[model samples]
Target: MYTLILISTMTNLSEIRALVLPYYEDVALICAIITALPVLVGIILYLSKNHISKPSTPKDAEALVEYKKYFTEKELEKLEVPYVQRIENNIERDVIEEAADFLKSSEQVLIICGESGIGKTKLAIEISIKINESKELTGNFKFKGNCLFANLRHYKNPKDIEEKLNAKLSEKTVLIFDDYQYNMEVFNEIKNKALRRNSKLIITTRPIFVKALKEKIGEVSIRKIKLGRMDINGILKDLEDGDLKKVERISEGNPAIALLALDYIREDPDRNAKEVFQGIRTSKDFFDKIIKDFQKEYGEDFIEFLAEGELTGGVANIPQEYEKTMIEMEKSGHIAKHESKYHLTPDVLSEYLINREFFSGTILKHSFEELARADNGTYILEMLNSIMKIKDDREIYRKAAAKLLEIVDQLEPNAEQKKKRIKTGIMVYDGFGSLNLVTEKLKEFWTDYDILQDGKDLLDLGIFLIKISKPYEARKCLEKAEEIFSKNHDKVGISSTSHSLGIIYQQQGNYEEAVKKYNQSLEMKEELGDKSGIAITLYQLGNIHYSQGNYEEAVKKYNQSLEMNKKPGDKSGIAKTLHQLGMIHHDKGNYEEAVKKYNQSLEIKEELGDKSGIAITLHQLGNIHYSQGNYEEAVKKYNQSLKIKEELGDKSGIAKTLHQLDRIKKDMDRLKEKMGEENFEKAYQKIESNNK
Candidate 1:
């Protein structure tokens, strides 16, 4: 119609132009839409590919929202158990009240000691709240956030926060220094200032810190409160219907473990409580989560630093850059700051880091060498030897031992420090796994060291002989040491000699003599309050019982040792005890229980990267399968064991696994032949029946 109008009206130029313009405009609009379709389609595809679903928010976190301004509520919640104003007749509550009362007393510092997850931080928080609400001091008391929980290192400017702290020292500020175990300079500075300002300094840390604090600050009358587990009956009643008793036993009275169990029960409601409790202890994933958080907050390098320091008996100088991090770690309960050095909190965490790839042979050797160069480095050398004994990493120990030997040899010959370090290394030759090297070093330096001048030298020589598998020589040296210790009235030395002699008797299969000597050692250790020595003697006794097939008695001794081991986070001891338990179960035809215990031991071994330990566990598992008539599974497990043994250069282990594989093959062949005979019999019977 527009065309007709334009054609009809020669003078209708405006109409024609208008129609053309409209047509062009419509075409342009269509072109624009076509172009946009591809772009729109691409954007849609891109969004679909890259999209991530949002995580569901935690409802439990809502309860913590009010304290968000003072802390990262989520982080604080992780650091401590949920707050409780009062638990009737609770031991932890009593400790809190005592600590709070101490804060109001003339005491300048209050030290609270307990194992991790025992509600130390929670107790501190409650005390702070109580003190703050009551205006316990001059002005309205201000509760500073948990010092250990604060990441002062990550702060944009730490000086500003420090200045604010200094400015508020005149006020009724309750500075809660949770888990202070290292950086004595900072601790001393803060302690002095807090005392000068009359501000309350409340500290919560591992029991080891009490010893460390005493070492750092000298004998100050700081009121010490040791937090124990809450009463079991009340906890059971409070938890309502659940395996609270099992939780109590497995968690060993740890509030954190109980809380975690409650969380699991609330989540599934049907999962076995005992199993859930065990999962918390044995699950690698749970440990990984805690370790990841520690690493994220303080960084892996700082963790490495702490681990190396611990290997040296918690002796290390905190770098200026790490000062804030150290404080934050202490506050967070990941580490403890006592004076100038730092120690990791929850000994298990230290064990985890020690077994990590970050603590490689090279790194360990470097740390050892660094300590060897420091003043009183001999103490660190002794500590290294002790750690190496627990680790049993032959290659790692060899490298470190050689380096230490070299360092001591090069030291001003005849120097007391040099002799002391050499003696320390010699005392732990069994741990070093370098009998020939240590022997050579010993011979080369013997005369120069004049080791016979001191009674302790005989102890070192005796330990070296024992490690070298020369029981006869060990007996002679230990007897000499005993004589010297007796003459010198060194009760501790005599006890040590008795322990060394016990090891010799054990090696010689003289169980009676071994037990007698170990008992002597145990009695002395108990008298000296040396829990570690007592644990070692008890474990040795368990070994004797296991060898004699007295499984029940062995378990009793092992359990006692295990309880003591728990205090120090002795993973090696735990794994050894578990492995022994697996052996007992296997001997008793408890295949399922044996498998569980073996798997648990294997997990810890794998974490420690103890290839020999892993192979041993695998072999035991194969034995269990073989007993159960699972030939194929037995073969698989045997092969896995063989592979690891071969990699470890364990000739005896490889040979043992090979023999097992041969046995399995023969068993398989016999099984097939028996099956064939049975099938023939069935065929014959079928034919006879048909014929009839």
Candidate 2:
């Protein structure tokens, strides 16, 4: 019985094990699938990101190995630095990609241009390296050129460069002419031979010197990349946690300069932004070093020619004595050849050299002496004309005027240069707002010289004298001018002199005399078809009429003046007319019309940067607001007018604005008492809410 029970229990245990075995297998399979799913997904993602694929052929493996060879491990490491790695705004990246694509598409010449210290060289190196490493590339790629200034001097001509480049460009080579000064000879030789379909030439240079290449090669097939301030922001990224912005602000969009400035700031944390910028601007170290090196190799005279050559045009007109020096300097990267001329590298260096020469007075004195001797007058006149063109500071104009006067004093009494010199001096003094000095200088010359007998000269002097409020003295000169004009039958001269006399009479309150002279001038101007002169006479007549309360006549005259000025695109004349029209409307109590006219005048004046005119219009606008019971708005406009007046040093305008402000304050106090503080605010709220 016990044997039978043990056999039965064994049978039951064996059946239980058989039933659970299948379920155990299912649980293990499910666990294994859950564990493998993440690993499979991760592998797929990695492959997708890296574009990894198994090589199907031996050539594929070889190509991969070759692509990796373009950048050595050491070079790859260098790119990790922010200076190399950081690319701001993708400007450099887009350029690099465009260049690479061009090179691949068989574009022969790629010119990269920018101001110096703007990272042209680095960008070029980056481009070359990227091209070499491209997977699509096919050839024994070689990027070889002597971009060093020292090495560049050895290349006397394009033939010398081509000879050296010939071997490297055997299998799709890139010849890098870093900061190349392309002359017609060099460009022609390379364009024919080295710049073939199989090989490419990459040139880096400043923007100022690229005109020559463009002129020679024609803009058809040339590919150009301009590195700009936006590109230099790459340095900002590499700046990491330091004062990158400070360095960038100091650099003024120059990468190399920013790097130098960063190093400078790191050396002494105490240095401020102003000091750093000043140091960068004032530092002649870059050019000084180059000059010193050249001086040692060549001589002091060679450097002097380099200095003078840059100042006065270029190497073409330089004395034959410095021909070899010019060539050497061009090779040495101190100067670049463009447009059949030689310009200094890094334009700012040229500016610094010019300023240095100007202050030294040697070159300036020599030029002055030459002008005095030649009596050609054009050069000196051009120099003075440039001062006016640029609208230089009063101090600069004063100094220039003084120097020109000294030159004039040294010139021959009846020399043409002396005449031009006086004319230039008067122009400069007039611009400087020192017309009294002009009067003094002209009077001094007139007392000593016999130039006043000339009708045109007397008329010019008379008009200028009247402008400076010397109407009494101007009358004598005008009478003389009229006499000469009458004898010569110069209708144009008579009209101009008569108009000037009318101005004097009008200012002296002789309304009838002024009207008669103006009408006479207008008749002659009409006969001569001088639209400009007619417009001037009409404006004067308008002013006289307005002063005498003839509003309708004034409006008509101003409208005619406006039409004449519009034909000539005389923005200032249009603004003046609009301003006068606004004044007339204001006097007539047409506040809305007056405001529109004043605003139109203000827009034109602001566009022209006519600060004085802007202030006047703002003042008028303030008056309109004050009349409209908008005291707060009036104060705001008055303040704006006053601020501009202070900036312009217009004492009269300032006084007027201040008086308006005082009157507005008193009006506000009275209004406050009459309406109470709350009521006054409510009234201001309504005015403010009104869109005028």
Q: Which 10 consecutive positions of candidate 1 have the poorest summed lDDT?
A: 1-10
Error of 1 at 82 (Å): 35
Q: Which sections of candidate 2 miss by over 4 Å?
A: 1-357, 360-382, 392-425, 434-451, 606-611, 629-655, 665-692
Model 1, global lDDT:
0.60
State candidate 1's TM-score: 0.43
TM-score of each: 0.43, 0.48
Whole-model lDDT values for every prediction: 0.60, 0.61
lDDT of 2 by residue, 280-373 (tens): 6545642343334444555766556655444444456767877777776665445767788776664433433433343444323344345433
Give the alpha carbon lDDT tens digit for every residue of 357-442 in model 1.
22343223455456666764555564554355344332334445566666665565546755665565565454533345564554
Q: Which candidate is the best by TM-score?
A: 2
Model 1 stretches with alpha carbons more than 4 Å out: 1-468, 563-569, 607-612, 639-651, 665-692
